[model samples]
Every structure is written in C-alpha cells, then in structure tokens.
Target: MFNSLQDKLDKALQNIQGRGKISEINVAETVKEIRRALVDADVNFKVAKDLTKRVQDKALGQNVLTSITPGQLMTKIVHDELVDLMGGHQEGINLSAKPSIILIAGLQGSGKTTFSGKLANFLKKKKNKNPLLVACDVYRPAAIDQLKVLGSQIGVPVYTEQENLNPVQIAEHAIEHAKQNQQDVIIIDTAGRLAIDEQMMNEIRNVHQFVKPSETLFVVDSMTGQDAVNTAKSFNDVLDYNGVVLTKLDGDTRGGAALTIRTVVEKPIKFISTGEKMDTLEIFYPERMADRILGMGDVVSLVEKAQEQFDEEEAKKLHKKIAKNEFGFDDFLKQIQQIKKMGNMKDLLGMLPGVGKAIKDVDINDDAFKHIEAIIQSMTPEERRKPSLINISRKQRIAKGAGRKLEDINALMKQFEQMGKMMKMMQGPQGKQLMNMMSKGMPGMGGGFPGMGK
Candidate 1:
C-alpha cells in the first residue's frame, strides 16, 4: 500500500548513503524530501510537516552512533518515528463485558457490514467466543439479507427484525437475544448514509447509547485518503470510538490514511482488512507495518501467516512421503490449498523481503493456479498417484478432458517432474546442507527487475 511513498523515502535515505559522515544539511534535505513524499501520498499537510520535523531531529541527534553510516542511521530514526506515529503498541478489542457489544460505525460503502461478519468469524475461531451478528442496518436494502448470508457462511447466528426499521430498538433487543441464546459476544452493524447526514448521525448516536457497547469501532475506506481522516474525526467526536478499522487496504496504494489516521483521531487502529475475504482481516501491528513501508519486509507477519496454515501431523506425514519419493499431485493439491488460505497469490509473494518492490509492477494473477489444478484433476486417480504412466496419448486425452491445450499439459508435467526431483534432493546430504545454509542466509534479499536498477 505504501508503494510510491516507500520509493520516495528509500531514495531520500539513499541520497546520503555515499557520505563518509552525517551532516545537518544532508539530513535537512532528506527530511524535506520525506515531507514532500508524505504530502504527495495524501497525508495531512500538518501531520506530514510534524512527522518530517521529528525525523530530522532524531537524525541530527544520531551522530554519536558513529559506526553506522548516515543512511542506516536515518533509516533507524525514520522507522522508530513511524512506529510512534502509528500507535507504538498493538491494541486488541475489548471483550470484558458479558455478551460484550461491539458497535460498528462508518459511512455507506465503507464495508461496515462485511467487517462485522469477518470480526464474528475471527472471534468465533481465534478468540473462542460465540458471537451473534446483529443486522441493524435496516434502512439499506438487502443489508439484513447480506448479514444473513455472511453468518451462514461462517456458521454464526445472525439477529434480525425484518419489519422493524429502528436501529436502536433492534440493537438493544439483540443484546437480550444474545444473552438468552448463550452468545457471549454481540456485533451490531449500524446503517450508514451516503454522506454524513444529520439524521444518520443522530440515529447511530442513539443506537450507541442504547447498546452501551463495550467497544465501538469506526470502519473507514483506506483508499479515501484525507477524507477518511476527516470522517474519522467526525465519528470520534460523536461515538468516541475505541478504535479504527481500515478496510480495502490492499486496493489503496497511497495508504496515507493508515499513516495519519491514528495521529489525527488519537485512536489505535485495531484491524486492517484487505480484499473481500472474511479471513483477510489482520490485527494492526505498528512495527510490522513500518517494516513494510520502508521495504524492510514483514518476515514476522509472513511466518505468522504460514504458521496459521501449518498442520503438524500433516507435515510429519508429508515429510515421510517426500523421504520415500511418494509425494504426488494429491499432495501437491493439498499444499496449494494451504497456500491459497494464506491470502492472495500476489500479496503472498510480496511478503518476501526483496520481492515486494521487485514485483510492484507485475500483474501476478490471483487465479494463476486454477488451470494447473484443473489439469491435475482431469487425470485418472492412478495416473495422478503415478505420474510416470502419463505418456503422450494420456497427456492428449487429459488435455482434451480439461479443455486445455497439449502444450499446457506438457508444461504441467515438466513442472511436476522438476518438483519431484526437488523433493528427492531435499532428502539428500547436499540438499540438506543447502537448506541449513538458507536457514542462515541473507534474510531480506532486495529483489530487482531488468530495468529496476535505477
């Protein structure tokens, strides 16, 4: 999301990398460029000024660390400032209240309803809470049905009063329903107007008071830039929300709202959502985000995501198969499923240290694995388990069955054979040594393209 901003900041820091020593003039010049970058990224003018000024101060005072170059010192200073700017600590939702109520507020099209569903799924799966989603957005057509569909998908129960259009009554009554139904948490989705209308604000404020929520969250569209910050301020003034949720961050390349919202509203961002998938919501971590912004890569987050999809028992079984050279298309398909669950294909690749900036201009399709999966599925069960039997005739049959070309089938076979060889290598002495070396290898390799050296 911090694409252009990262490029500019990286260039600014690189400007002094050749210097033998740190100087005030060079630091000032770098700071000026950073400020310009922040402004161009849609950050509030005053916030950009203040951020760069603080960075300048920190950079000037870093001269005592003489062992480090100016570029490295400035990078450290900027990283620390970014962490501070984005709420130094990660904050979680408040769930202390019995049948804890979480009221979601935001403008229409801000993804408030969808976020409620994702939050319900997260709490139910991760936090071990029985959550009830309250469909309180009665004014919007199909809003109730939308919540119902989301609940059905996640296996969570949704509360709705189809005839009642009053959100306050619906919210208040939903709490009682949750208590009787043994639902430990209640997430109320309020109606959002196209613009901040007086009636809309008053209705939400009333609902907030009636529900007396344990925590209130203001959902914002991150792509809206400065307008998001301004909307957050208005909502904070009325709702006094406990935290913020920045939605559609994957579509937002500027990401100025994420950088500036916390400072503007003085609220911690509890969650950031990317794409429409319910599993794409993530807890906001300031330091990890800062790492991503500076092209340092978020290895920690990437590892955490991988850990989420890792199955210990399955791993042991897969290891045995690999050692025996019995891994086949079925196993390959299982691995693909786990990887798909991690997130979008492109976003997953971008998590690698050097690859994020390197592939910024590349169009890595999310459905790139679909055709490969189809070809594999077209093969007979025995042929899949024993790819050695798939001769030219079989390949042509499978290609016609899968509605793909002979060349595509040939490519898949070649790749699958190469993967089989790789698995065998991993069980050998040399491959084991290479794996160990990679365990201690250069962690964040900066990826480059043909014309990217500039």
Candidate 2:
C-alpha cells in the first residue's frame, strides 16, 4: 500500500491542521512537503509538480468555513486533486457485444496471465458473463499451462493450442469456439517480452488488430514505481489501450503507478489486482483509493465485500439461534468462514477508519482463526451444538485431537461464553446502548481473537 506516502502526507498536513487560518506561507510549506512526498513515492516529477500546483491554488483560493480547519480544507483540495489525477470515477469494462472480447497486454511477469484469469472469474461471478480464457501466448508454453490451471480453479474453460504458434490465429479460433459454446466474453491473454521490443510489439499489435477487442487493458506491476508509468506510456502510445490494470498492489510498493499512470497515459485504471487470488481483483475507484491513501480507509468497499458474503436467510437463521441462546461452535465456525471469504484479515481491518495506521506494525495473521476452527472441528456434532455437554474429559480429548493445549481450549470456551452473553444482551432493549458503550471501550479490551492470547 501507500503507507509511506500516507505517513508523509499526514506529517505534511499537520503543519496547517491546527493553524487558525489558511495562509500563503503555510500553504506553500504544506504543498512543498506534499510534492516531496509524491516524488519520494516515485511519481513522475512533472505530474507531481502539476498536481501539487493545482492543490496549492485551490487551497489558497478556498474560504475555510467556521466548521472547517485550514488543514481540513487543504486536505480536501489535495484529495480532489488526487482523484482527478487518477480517473475521477470508476470505468467499467465494455461487454456490450454478443461476445465482448477483452485483450490483455503487458510486459512479461507483470501478472497479465493471472489478471486475465481474475478478470474471467470476476466476469463470471459478478458480471454474470460466460467468459472464455484464451491463451494467446504462443511463445510461452508455461503461460498456457498457468492459464489452464487458473481456469480450472475458477471453473472457466481455457482455450489453448499447444501446436499453434500464431497468437492471432489462436485468438480468432477462440472467438469461434466461444460463439459455439455460448460464452459471452472472451479474454485473450497476449504474450509479453522482458522489455519493449519490435517483435513482441508486432505480434501483440497483430493480435489486437485481428481480435478488435471491445476493451484492451494494459497491465503493469505497481511495484515498479516510476518505471511502471513509463512502460504504460509506451504501450498506450502504440495500442491506445482502453484502460490500465495495476497488479501486485499488495507488494511493498511505493504506489507510484497507481497514482500517476492515468495522468501520464491518459487512460482510466479499470482494475487493481491485490494478490494472486482469482477473487482479489477490484474495479478501480479513484475516490476510495484517495481515501485509503489519506489514511481515511475505505468503509464502502469493506461493506461491499461483507455484503458479497452475506446471506439473508443465513443471517435470519443465525439471529434466531442467538435469540434462543442456541448459537454454538458450528455457527461460530460459519461466521469465521464468511469473514475469511472477505479477503485478507489485515486488509479487512485496514478498512476501518483509523485501524490501518494503528495496526501498521502489528502482524494480524491470516490464519488467526485457524486454531479456533480446529478446536471447533475437533468437537463432536453434539458437542458443537451443545458446548455445555463438553466435560473436562471431553475437553482433554478435543484438545488432543486438535493438537492444541488444554489451556487453549479453556480460553476459547471462556471467549465463546462471553460472546454468547454479549449476543444475548444485543437482543434485549438496551442492546443499542450497550453497543455504543462497547464501541467506545473495546479498544481498551487488550485481547486478540479467542484462543489467540494477548
């Protein structure tokens, strides 16, 4: 993430935050710091300068309201500028054609193959499109295999021609196959070279001309910093891509490409790929990204992720069980599974307003719930439904089966009991009041999840 840039921006904004009013001197100082922060993040110097200049102009011209501090005004100006620097709004893929073709292009090792799989998965799951993954990388045999593996993982059909060395022909054949199979979307994964070259460019250009894709995306590794933006510019000059895709955003990246690629290449960033997971692709939202960069977090995206995993009937059933005091280990396990489906635990926590900065140094393991899950799985069906039936002997057996210590089981039981009691309280008349108090005080609780001791 842009943790480093976020820290720098925070410190920069602090200069004008407590001031009584916005002044030319303070604005200049803050804008200078902001420029330096962008440069440090490896943003193109010209783009950085132009953006900060706009921010400074807006900051000085704005009238700080009685309710708003100088820092607040300045931050708003910068946020808006950043949003405009990226695309101001989200740009979706164009899939209106009967069989919309999306051509994926990028440098070698830029996660093009992986993103093609992810895009296919996203289209199948979210857009309700029957997508066919066409492996057009005739130069790399391994790429075709990788596409096949990913296609299998996502349950999408991958079209590959091991004997065919012409990508344009492969793509043309895949389209006919898609039409016959009733697939509505075709994502052709084109080949890439280590760096820009004439032969690679000619091959991809020929494929692009033959496919006439509804959308062409240029994928780049976000961790490459300024170099990523440069590569994007080179590609855009030739292909004039419809949009850009930033991959490997979860890496220890300075986030230069995400911040400046649109400005340099004049293309909207349509998608961002965080991890290798097929479900980890996100439609790019410039506003939410600005919020995250400013350490404001992305609550809307967090809620969207939660809603994707939410089942209305399941919730009603769980609520009924909790009201009857029947919530047990099985229900708890199901809740944990839903949370796991929401993506990485640390990333989910980072979506909270202030939690990202607070836990920047704290390692929140993705497997934080594994021990709890193991202990629950070790219980018998009856024990899972009625934990009260677990006597001391049963506890020892369950702990041994889970390869955990007896103390771990005891701690989990205590936490479960507390959670049950809390749920019961939530069902009562004073539930809202209790929740308010808990929201204010839970930060001081000084404990991790059940079985994860402080």
Candidate 3:
C-alpha cells in the first residue's frame, strides 16, 4: 500500500532523531528530505513543496516543550499535513435524494464495474439502502454479465437492458424502475475507453445530465501513479464528480494518486478498493491513511472489520463451547470460514498499519487455509467434536482422506493448540496487560487478533 513511500518518510524523519531542538538549519534539512520523499512517491512537485513548507513552518512555530521530542514533533506535523493534503475529514457519498443516483466514470480496466458492485454492496449493508445496479456498458456484453455475477454474489439486483444500445435510455429506464421497485439507490456503470475520448466523456456526461445523480464517482487505478491524478482531473473537468474511488490500493502503488488527487481535482477520495472482491471496498479516511503511510498501523479499521463480521449469537455459542473446554476442530474450521468471508487475507492484512510494509516481500497465498479446511472437512462429525480421540492410525487415515501428509495434519494441530491457548489467556484477567505489552512489541499481531481487547 505505499510501503516505499513510508520507508522514505521514516528515514527522512530519522535524520532529526538526536537533535535537541527544532533549529532552522535542521528543519530545512528535514523538510528537504520530506519533499524528496513525496516526489519519489510520485506526488506533484508543487504539491510536495507546498506541503513540506507548511510542515516546516508548523514545526518551527512550535515551542520547545519537554512534552515531546523534535522527531516526534516533526512526525506529528507531517502527519497533519499529509491528512490535510488528502482532505482533513472523511467525505461520504450523497444519498439525500429519493432514489439517489450514483454515476461511475473511469477509463476502461480501471475497475469501474467492480467498484460499482462494491459501492452498491456498501450502501446496501452499511447505509441500509436498497440499491439497484444498472448495467449501462452496452459496448461489452460481458460487462453486463460481470455486473450481474457481482450483483448475485452480493445479493443485489442488477438492472440491464440488453436490447437497448443507448446507455442514456437504459439509465433513465433504470431510475424509473428503481422508483417503482422502491429501490433507494441506483448506481449506473457506464462504458469506458482505453484512454479518455470525447465520445466516452459525452456518453457519461449525457447519462449524468439525465440521471442528475446525487453523486458521480471517478474511479482510477492507483497503480498508475501520477497518471491516476491526471485522469481524475480530466474526469472532474468533464463530469464535475462529487468524489473519487481509488482502486487497486493493495497493489504496489507508490501513493502518488492518493496524496495528489484531492489537491489536483478538488474532490475527496470517497472510497478505496483493496481487492477484486466485492467486500473489499472501504470508506477512505485521511488520518488512517496517513497513519498507515507512516508505518503506525490502522487499528481503527482493523477493529471495524472485526465488528462487521462479529455476530452476537455466534459469539455466545463459541463462548459457551470455550467455557466447557469443548472448542475443537469444528469450531476452528468455522472460524476460518468466517474470516474468509471478510475478504482476501492479504488485503485484510494490508489494512493493518505496520503489516503492509512487513509483508510486502512475503508471499501470502490467498488460499493459505486451503489445506487446513480440506483436512477438517475430511474428518467425521465425531472426529471434529473430539479431535483428541484421534489416534495415530486415525491421523494417517484423515491425512490420506484429505490428500495431505501426516506432517500437515500435525502442523495444523500444533497451530490449533497454540490458538486455543491464546484464546484462554485472552479470557484471563492478565490478558489486558499481556495484550498491551504485545501491542507495543509487535503491532502486526494486534491487527490479526481482533475482538480480543477492548
């Protein structure tokens, strides 16, 4: 997610580690480094200079109090400046009007269709609005099918007119259909070109005029770096979009678009698409993103993801089983399934503040739990309930049945045991103390283990 930029910024701040006070000479050196880091991240040169100047001025103005060190002060100033650069506050989609219309515009393969599905799912679940996805990409028949598949996966209805080639007419009819069906929101996914063209812009503009959308979102691939910012500006010039959606943030994006899009286009980043899955869409938060870029970890977002997946009834049942010391392979398998439902593992891990950089080089398969799931599914209900009763012969049989080796089964058992022990410890009085210590020692673990503290 911006690991390279984060490393550069961290190194830049480290240059003032031993400084006793914020002097003009030292501040200038640090500011220069900061500006260089932003430029390396693909930020617009002028934006980077303006931001660093503001940070420098803020640092120089601060009184040298014993409450914080120079390095800490500089980090704080830069954090605030980064937040301000990306929009100091969170901006939400406008759903004020009845049958609120949201028009999505972007270049082809920029993830516009996927983002439309994600946004519809987001509004349906988080905003409690009934959303109808309209397939207006008449040029590609596959585009309509893609939206339909996504709509089915998210349990959202998709409206498409296969016979009508005019997108404007399709959108107009979809809105009317929404009104009759009591759909609170209508998201129109229009066609796109490999590059920006007059015909594409005109088509989207015509739809925008006919729908008069409450919000028009410009989706851009962050992996494209500065080009993303420029495309955003062009789209904003044409459609006057209400917000921007930065997709493929989970990729090796240098953080250029995120830092400069708002400055260039004057539109807040409303959402970020971390993965190809529909559940991977997240509302953009400036402060959280700044924290992530600084390698400080985003605990707030981690907790929110946990809360969204937490079911009170399921929690109570699990608690009862744990209290009885009956937590076994079945429960563990169920837990894995629940986590898989949350989203892709790498994407979820990247949302954790420090884990993004740490795992940047590590190969984490999205199907890391495949073998574990297969082993569990091979077991009988009795075996799942009482894993301890399985002898060496049973182990070999289970391994063979799952098409895995005996060592694989043994390794899974070890991990399962460790997890059980940790859960037990978390349920103890000293758990909070231990958790606090671990949070400070290994921030990455804090992200993976949610709902254990607080």
Candidate 4:
C-alpha cells in the first residue's frame, strides 16, 4: 500500500526521534521532510503544507515527558493529523429505511459495477440486509451481464431490464421487484459517466432524484491519485453524494486519493476496495488507515478478516486433532483455504505491526500455496489423513502426480513433520509457555506460518 510514503515518514520522524525534547530547529527540519514526503506521495501541496504546519505547531507546543521520546510524540502528532486529514471517524451507510436505496456513481473504469456487487455481498453478509442489485447502466455493452455475473457470485439477485434501455424506468421497476421479493436494500449501479459529459451526468442526476437513495456513493480509482479527488469533487458538485468509495486501493502506494479526497469532496470515505475480490471491501477507518500508512499495521482489521472466515466448530475439531497427534495434510489444506478466504497473502501479512515495511518489497503471491495445495490434493485419502504413510516410493509417486520434483516432496514432508512437532508441543502441558516464548522472540508470529517451518 503506502509503502514508499511510510518509509519516508519514518525517516522524517527519525530526525526528532532520539532527541531529548522537541526543539524548533529539529521540528522544522522534520516537518520539512514530512511535507516533502507527502508531496512525493502525490498529496495536494496545500493539504500537505497545512497538515505539516499543524504537526510542527503541535510538536513545538508539546513538552516531552520522561516516559516518551520526542520521536514518539512527534509520530503520534503526525498520525493524529493524518487521521484528521482523511475524515477523523468512520462513516457507515444508512440502511435504516425499508429497502434502503444506495446509488453507485463514478467515471468509466472506476470499478463501479464490481463495487456494487461487493457492496451487496458486504451488506448481505455483514449488515444482514437482503440487497437487490439494479443494473442501470444502459449504455455500456455487457454492463448488465457483468453485474449479473457478480450477482451470481455473491448469490444476490440482480435486477436488470435488458430490453428497457431507460435506466430510470428500470430502477423504478427494480424497486417494485425488491419490495415484492422482501429485499431490504437496493443498490442501483448507475452508468459510468465522465464529468464533462453533460447528458450522462444529467442522466445520473435524474436517477438520483428518482431513487432518493439513503446512501449515494461516488466510486473512484484510487490509483488515479489527485485526479480521483478532482473527479470526486466534480461528481459531488452535481450529486452531492453521501460518501466516497476508493477502489484499487491495494495498488495505490502513494495514497494521494485516500489522503486528499475527503478534504476535497467534503465527504467521509465510506468504503475502500483493495482488490477484485468481493470480500475485499472494507469500511474506511481513518485511524486504522493512518496506522497502516505509518507502518504500525492494522491488527484490528486483520483480526476482523480472520474472524469473518473463522469457523468455531472447525477450530474445535482441529484443536482436538492436534491434541491427538492426528493433524495431517488434509487439516493443513483446510487451514490454507481459511487463510486464503481472509484476504490476499501480502495484504494479510501487511496487517501485522512492523511486517508491512519488512515485506514491502517481497512478492507474497496470492497463490503462494499453489504448489502445496497441489501436492496435498494429489495425495490419496489415506495419505492425506495419515501423512506418515508416504514413504520414499510414495513420495516419488506423489511428486510425479503433482508435477513436482522428489526434493519438493521431501522438503514438504520435512516441514510438515516439524509443524506436527510444534503443534504437539503447543497442545501439551507446556503449550502456553512455548507460545509465550515464541511470541517474545517473534512478535506477531506466535503461530508459525503454513509451509514456513524449517
């Protein structure tokens, strides 16, 4: 994410970090570096200057206590200012109305249609709302089909009037359909229009007026940088949307749109779409974002993601298996699946405090478990249930079956044995002690990673 900006900010804070107290000279130098870093990240020059000035003033005004260093205080000040810069608190969608209407608007290629599907899934899963997705993009070819595909993926019904070219009429009809179907939420995916297109803009306005949505979100591609902010302003001027949605945020290393859009559009960032996955949508939290941008990680969000994919019953069963020394490749494969459901590998790792910077340059592929999965899948039922049965001949057979080298099988077997030993130890009387020791030695790594044992 904002890896470059985070590194720069860390360096900037280092200027006053080791100092006894905040001094004007050191504060000035640090603030200057901070401003440069912000500008380099594509943040608005004025916004960057205004934020750094506030940080400097706060730093100079503070009297450092013996408990905290100047660097810690300075980092705290900057984090707070950054939070304020991006909307101080999270803003949630208003779904109080019976079948609350949410209008999605944005420029073409802004991931509007995909976000609509994701939003529907989020509401269906998180908000416990029965959402009906209305595809209102009459102009774009296959736009309806695209929405239908997404709707099927999320198991949400998409209301589309293919024969009816009029979006307003389709939306009205979709509302009636939602009422009849007992749907409590209607997300109208409007056509993607350019700010300069008066006719298209007017069309979206008409739909907005007709629907009177409880939440009108303006989606923008965050990787567009300042242009995303400017486009948001243009849309806000016309529709005055309830909030903004930043899509493709995972690819945004500079984070200009996330930092500047709220201040420019005067709307809270309601959601952030990090990837193409329907479950990748997250409620925009300024504090959490500021934490991530400053290399502090977002442990809370990470835990939430894990919880979403966690199966309590399955955990209990796995614990029993571990205690019995019966944890096998099949159980390991299921764990990998659950982790994959949590989110992208790199993104999941980046949520740990101090891990983001460490893995900034590392390519932690989403399909990192591909080979392991293949190997596990190639094993017979007996082999999966009892990996100890896979002798040298079995290893060679499995290797050929999985299209892998014999050494790869050997490596996996060795690692799996080590993991089994660790699990057994953790399930024993000294489990808690072992966990504490591991945590102290490697914070955020109390549970060793899958396929990561030596």
Residue 297, candidate 2: Cα error in Å is 0.8
Alpha carbon lDDT of residue 391, candidate 2?
90
lDDT of 1 at 421: 90
lDDT against the true structure, per candidate, is 0.88, 0.90, 0.88, 0.89
lDDT of 2 by residue, 313-396 (tens): 999999999998999999999999999999998888788777777777788899989999999999999999999999999999
Q: 1 or 3, which is superior by TM-score?
A: 1
For model 3, the local distance difference test gives: 0.88
Which model is ahead, 3 or 4, in terms of TM-score? Answer: 4
lDDT assessment of candidate 1: 0.88
Model 1, 1-454: lDDT tens per residue?
Answer: 7888889888888887767766678778888988998899898899989999888777667562364666877888889988998999899899998979999999999999999999999999789999999999988868888999999999999999988988888887888888898999999999998889789889988998888899999999998999999999999999999999999988855988999999999999999998888898899999989988888888888898999899999999999988888888889999988988999876776677867877877887778789988998999999888888999999999999889999999988888888889888988898988788777884763355333323
Q: Which of the two candidates, 1 or 2, achieves a greater lDDT against the reference?
A: 2
Q: What is the Cα-based lDDT of residue 12 in candidate 4?
A: 89
Candidate 2 TM-score versus the reference:
0.93
Q: Given candidate 1, what's the lDDT at residue 299?
A: 83
- Candidate 4's C-alpha runs over 4 A off are 18-22, 64-68, 433-454
Model 4 lDDT per residue over 343-380, tens place? 88887888888878777776777887899999999899
Ranking the candidates on lDDT from highest down gives 2, 4, 1, 3
| lDDT of candidate 3 at residue 144, scale 0 to 100 | 98
- Tens-digit lDDT string for candidate 3 (1-454): 8878988998898888667765688779989999999999999999999999888778878853333677888899899999999999999878899979899999999999999999999998999999999999999899999999999999999999989999999998898899999999999999988998889889888888988999999899999999989988888888898999999988888999999999999999999998887888999999999998987778788888888988999899988887677899988988888888877676567767657766766677879889899999988899999878777898899999999999998988887888888787777778888878886786545444432222
Residue 413 miss distance in model 4 (angstroms):
1.7
